[model samples]
Target: MANKGPSFGLSRQIQDKINSKYDPELELILVEWITRQCSSDVGKPEPGKMEFQAWLKDGCVLSELINSLFPGEKPLKKTQSSSMAFKQMEKISQFLSAAEKYGVTKTDMFQTVDLWEAKDLAAVQRTLSALGSLAVTKDEGTYNGDPTWFFKKAQENKRDFTEDQMKAGKNVIGLQMGSNRGASQGGMSYGRQRQIL
Candidate 1:
């Protein structure tokens, strides 16, 4: 049977945007992080086969890639820190908190929120195409050094997401989902969006 699922791709348009917006070193770091995470979670042949460098930097791909490399493990719990590190550490802590609330991880792929409500696969596909799916790997919070920390953050903030908020969330997830799909689209296509069981 033909496998119908979302796939990832590297588009010239996106790559051009990233090249223009970010420094080459930053770009390489982001790409390497994403490629490594995708390669790791998807269990592909090798990291070199994962072409994340050519990806566009329009959405949260950079953040997601970073998260993938450095995950926050025990996300549900919070830690008390001194005021001395407040200026430097607050931002990082907040991001970890947010990611934990979302259960951030590379392998945690997204599905339609209404998947159970859809009567048929095609309907699900339509929803997925409109909203897009995401691979919730690493994000800003991953740098916290513990995947569980981010996971706990995800658990905490799971309810704060509204419908519109969820739609926006899909953009980043879609990119990761695309990576999992591989280069199936070839140069002609950047990614694929389809429903699956």
Candidate 2:
């Protein structure tokens, strides 16, 4: 007997949920990404429920894609100190909140925490990466359909002002009055009085 061709479509419920959560353009991008990442067969059709579920379970592809998008940035690392553990928990909480907004269940997120509890750093990293991927989907409509908006925003927020830069800014502000010391007619000089008519 000839082998039957692999099934090619997602279930209606899952498809509907995805559609509701993502815009059509974003959905297309996600479908293409999934097809590229999960399919081994040449000329394979779009991923079906089994393929989608398997991809979610494996998570390596999702993790790789996210890591590639954010080069030189690893947000999830093994916690060595108490402060690091606190920070990791805060990050996990944020991820859970974002994932919930994108329709991921708490139970699914708890599995990631379980990996952390087990001291499987690799697994936790992969899980956090997968969650990051899913969180991008929630940015579709609100962020002009750019999936990397959150990541970019997070990067911007992480940037800290250097002490030298802060001191330079203060110096600039302090020198403003000195710079205007000689200008009294057009530009007001410091401590100058305007006569009342």
Candidate 3:
């Protein structure tokens, strides 16, 4: 995109559509969540698209947010701010890695370019939403924000069955499987006429 210059015609419209997907309400929720988790030192972003982008562009706030979520030892060593493009990107990457280590699955994590380039802020919001949900679900007491900010993700409930139970269940068929009883191919099938070889 750097070499492609400005967006034009259909491309510009597509870009606008993508940008429109950014939700201000979710942004406020995320901003408040961050403010609560990391403290007032990180500062708040003005509620707008570019401001949100610029706030997280450096990734220092993000690194601090992830570190704050940790119980004791921080996954990120330092939350350094840098003006250099590569350094800024590196900080975002480190934040992402630390996030993954803190139980954010790869699917829930956003890429460095997503926040830095502002290509897909909605994706960034989704990542943050997932993070909030995870933190709420874990309930480890490290989470600092309001508990209602994000809904808790469903936890895994594993059930074990003994061999006797399994064997007894094998004879029973659930309604979901649908019964074949009292039914037969009494006539031609529905889809197509029977074809002769």
| Cα TM-score per model | 0.19, 0.26, 0.85
Residue 88 Cα positional deviation in candidate 3, in Å, after optimal superposition: 0.8
- List residue ranges in candidate 3 displaced over 4 A: 1-5, 177-197
Candidate achieving the largest TM-score: 3
lDDT tens digits by residue: candidate 3, 168-196: 99999899999899889888488887879
Task: Kindly list the per-residue Cα lDDT of model 2 for residues 89-167, writing each as its tens digit.
Answer: 5545544454455454555455444333332333333344354455464343222223552242232336689999888
lDDT of each prediction vs. the true structure? 0.33, 0.42, 0.89
Lowest lDDT 10-residue stretch of candidate 3? 1-10
Find the number of clashing residue pairs for candidate 2: 0
115, model 1: CA deviation in Å? 25
> Residue 178: error of model 1 in Å?
62
Best by lDDT: 3
lDDT score for residue 83 of model 1: 39
Residue pairs in clash, model 3: none
